[model samples]
Target chain A: MHTRAKLALSLTAVSTVLGLMIGVQYRQTSATAALGLGYLRGTVDTHTLTELKNLKASNQAAEQELTQLNDELNQFERVSSGSDKAMTAFQQRLTDERILAGITAVEGPGISVTLSDGASNGSDVEQILTHDWNVRSVINELFTAGAEAVSINGYRVVATSGVFCSGPVVRVNNHRLGAPFTIEAIGDPETLKSALDIQGGILDVLRMQGLNVTVPQIKQKIVMSAYTGSLPGSPTYSLNEAIPSLSNNGT
Target chain B: MIWLPILGLLIGAAVGLVSNWTIPVEYSSYLSIAILAALDTVFGGIRANLEKTFDDVVFLTGFFTNIFVAALLAFIGVQLGVDLYLAAVVAFGVRLFQNIAVIRRLVVTQIRAKRRRRFNTTS
Candidate 1:
C-alpha cells in the first residue's frame, strides 16, 4: 500500500510536469490556441456572426466590383500610356524617390528594427502595458519609413506575430515582450533613419508625441530577407500618408 | 486572440496590483510566497487555456501539412509582412480542424469496432 501510494504521487508529479511542458511549447508557438477560446466566447455572438456573414457576402460582391475596377484601371493605364508623357516621368521620379528614401520594396541582408515602449508610468498597473500604440505605431512607422523588416523584441512579426497592448505589457506574437525594445531592420540604415527624421516623419511625430524614438545604425552587416513587401497588389501604405485626409476634412 | 490576452491582462493586473497593495509589511514573507503562488496559478491557467486551442506538434506533420494553411497565409503577407491577427486566426482554425479530425477518427474507429463485435456475435 505504501509503495502504491508513492507511485501514485510520482505519477501525479510526472503528469504535472508533462502538462506544464506541453503548455510551454504551446505558448511558444500556438499562442492563439490559448487566446482563441476566449475570443470565440467573447466576440463571436449571433450579431457578430451575422455581421461576418454580411461581410462575406460583401466580399463576394467585391469580386465583381474588383473586375470592374481592374477594367477601369486598365482603361486608365492605356489612356495614360498614350498621352501623359510628363506625368509618366513624374510618377517614375516619385518611385525613384521612394526607392532613394528606402521606402521601396527591397530584398537583401540588412538591419532588423524592433520597437518596444511600455507605459513608463501609470497611476495604476493598468498603464504599464508594453504594447502601447505610442510604441507600436512608432514601430509600424519604422517599417513604413522603409524598415526592411522589424520584429518587436525577439518575436518575429511573421504574419502571425500578435502585436497589441495587454494591460501594461505589449504582446508581440502573443509573447509578452518588455521595454528597451530592440528593433533590427535590414536596409541602408542611413536612408531608413532619414525616412524617419525627414520633415514630418514618424520620428518627428514621435518626438512631438513625447515618446522616445531612437535609431541606432549598426556597423555589422544587416541581412534582409528578399521580397518581403506585401503580396503584389496588396494595399501600399506610405509613412504618414494619411496626414493628408482621405477626403475633405472640414465637412 | 484578443479576448483571452485581454482577459489575462486584466486578471494579471488585478492580481499584481492587489498583491502589492494588500500584502502588509508585517507579513512580508507571506506576501512574497502568495505572489509567487498567484503568478504560478495564473500561468497555469494561461497554459491550460492555450492547449485547448493549439497543438504544438501540428507544426511537424513531416509534409508541412499541419501548418500548410498558416504557411500560405504567411506567404500572402510576406510582402508587407504577415498580419499578426490573421496568423492567430489561421493558426487557431487549423488547430481546431486538427482536433476535430482526431475526434472524427477516434469515433469512426470505435463505431467500426462495435460493428465488428456485433457481426461476430450474430455469426
Candidate 2:
C-alpha cells in the first residue's frame, strides 16, 4: 500500500509538470491563432516582432521630418520671392527720383518760343534785342503754366540753373548763347500757348518792343536732352546729431 | 483503487490551469519531449503493477530519470543541430502504446478470471 501510494504520488508529480507545459503551449498557440498568425508563430518570435515595430516607428518619424523640412523649404522660397518684389519696387522708385532730378531725358507734347534781335526802329538798343530777362520771363511763365520740363538751346533747366546777360549774348546754365534763342517747354500744348498769349502778357510786351518774338509754336512731341553738367559737389557736412527732436520724428 | 492516479492527474491538470505558469519558447521543445517520456514511464509503471513486477525504487527513479534524460537529449540535439528529439518522441510513443496494450489485456484477463471463480462457487 505504501508503494502504491508512492507510485501515485510520482505519477501525479509528472502529470502536473506535463499539464503545466501543455497549458502554456495552449496559451501561446491560441494567442497566435487569434492574430491569424498561427502558421507563423513557430517561426517568428517576440524579438523579431519588436524589431519590426521599432523599424516602422523610425520610418514614420523620418517621414514626418521630411515633410517638416519640405514645408520650411517652401516658406524660404516664398520669403525670397517676396523680397524680389520689394527689390523691383525699390528700383522703380529710384528711376522716378532720377526723372524728378532732371538727370534723365524726357519727351512729351509742348510748345517752343523763339526770340531774335529785330531791325533797329530808332528805339533803344535793348528794346530791339532779345535780353536775358526776356528768356527768364518766358521760362517763368511756362513754369506757372505747369510745364513738366523746360530747356533752352538744348540745355536742361534744373532748379540750380542760372540765366544772365553777358556782353551781347545771354549766359544760360553757364554757357554763352546768341540771338535766336529757342526755349522748349513740355506741358499741355494749349495751356502753354494760352499762358503766353494772354492779353498784355510777356509775349505781347516782347512783341511791342520790336524784338522779333514769335508766338509760341505747339508741337506733338518735343524730346529734351538730359542735364549734361556735373551736379554740385557734396558739401562736407556731418550728420546733425544735435537735433534730438527731429530724430524722434523719423519713424 | 485504480482511479487514484487518474484523479491525481485531473487534480494536477486543474492546478496547472489555475497557476497559469508558462515557459519560454526556447525551452518548449524540451518540455514536450520530457512530457512524452513521463507519459511513457507512467504507462510502463501501470503495466508492471498489473504483471506483479512493480518496484517502488525503480518506478520512482524511472519517472524522474526518464523526464530528465528526455529533456537533456533534446537540449543536446539543439546544440548538435540534429532532430534527436523526434527519435526520443518515437521511442517513447511506441513504448507507451505497447504498455497500454499490455495493461488492457491484463485487466481483461483478471476480470474474466474473477467471473469464472464466482460462477464455480454459485454452481
Candidate 3:
C-alpha cells in the first residue's frame, strides 16, 4: 500500500479500535464503578444498621446502669439529705450516655456547608469518586467551627469515629456515605457561618476543589451523637463480649 | 461512533468471563490489570504480555465502573426495596452479558475477514 493509503488504513484501524476501546472502557468502568459503589453502598447500609444496632445496645446498657444509679440515689437521698454531692458521678454517667447514644441532637444555632463533586467540569461519566476535599475534610471544618458535635446523613459523629474512603465511598465510623453530605452542628449558626464563609476559610477551600457549598441553620434540631463505635452484637459489631465469638471461630 | 464505548464494554465482559473461568479467585472480583500483568507474565500464556494490556484496561474498567453502577443501583433500588448488593449483582450480570456479546461479534468478524482475504488471494 502507498504511504497515504497505508496511513489512511492505519488511521481507520486505530480510529475504529480506539473508538471501540473507549466505548467499552466507559461502559465497563461504569459497571465496575457501579459494582464498587454497590459494595460501598452495601457497606454503608451495613454500617447504618450496625450504627443503629450498636447504639441501641449501648442505650439499653446505659439505661440499665442509669436506672440502677438513680435507684441508689433515691435511697441515698431518703437516708440522708445534708449534701448529696455524691450524686454528681451518677448524673455525669447519664449525661455521657445521652451524648453517646446520639439522642442529643443539639439545637441552638449551627451551619451546614454542602460540598459537591469537584469533577463537575469533567464529563459526567468520567471515572472519579472521592475528591481530595472529602466528607472528612468538611467534618474537620465543622470541628474548627466549634461544632460541639456533628452528624452526616443521620449518622452521628463521635470522638472515635474516623473518616476516610473505602473503595470510592467515604466512610465515617465504617458508615459508607454518598454525596450531598449533610453536616449537622450545634453552635451559634451565624458565627459558625461567618467562620466558614470568611475570605480564606472553609468555603474557599470547597470552591478551590470545584465543589458547591451552602451554609444553612438548623432552625429545628441537630442531633450529633457523642460517638458511633462498635458494640456487643451483630456478626460484625461486638464491642463488649466480642471475645467469645472470636474464640469460637478459633475453635 | 457512540457505539464504540459499548464495544469496549463488551470486550470487558469477555474479559470477566474468560478470567472467571480460567483464573481462580476466591471472591470472584477481577484481578487488576496491574496484577494480571504479573500473572500473565508468570504463567506466560502465549502472547500474554500483549493480552495483559487489554485485560488490564478491561479489569480497570470493571473495577472503576462498578462504583458508578453501585451508586445508581442504590438510588433506583430504593424503589424496589431490595438490598443493595442484590440489586448490584443483577446490574453487574446484565452488563456482563451485554459486554460479552459485542466482543464475540467483533472477534468473529475479524476471523471471517481473515479467511475471506486468504481465499480470495488463493483463488
For TM-score, the strongest prediction is 2
User: Candidate 3's residue-wise lDDT over A1-251, tens digit each?
Assistant: 24333333333333333333334444555555566663787767777999999999988987787567556645654443444454454445645555544444444456665665655555453323445346677677777777766787767777666677667677777878877677777667776677667887766766665666665544445545434455333212222233253233333
Candidate 3 CAPRI classification by DockQ: incorrect
Instruction: Judge candidate 2 at residue A135 and give its lDDT.
Output: 89
Q: How does chain B score by TM in each prediction?
A: 0.33, 0.93, 0.40
Give the best candidate by DockQ: 2
> Could you list the iRMS of every candidate?
14.8, 2.3, 11.1
lDDT by residue (A231-251, candidate 1, tens digit) is 223233523242133112211
- What do the candidate models score in CA lDDT, each in turn? 0.47, 0.78, 0.53
Q: Provide the TM-score, chain A, model 2.
A: 0.57
Best by lDDT: 2
Better of 2 and 3 by lDDT: 2
The list of candidate 1 runs beyond 4 A from truth reads A1-53, A83-134, A137-163, A167-169, A172-180, A185-215, A218-251, B1-123
Evaluated at residue B17, the lDDT of candidate 1 is 37
- Cα lDDT for residue A127, candidate 2: 79
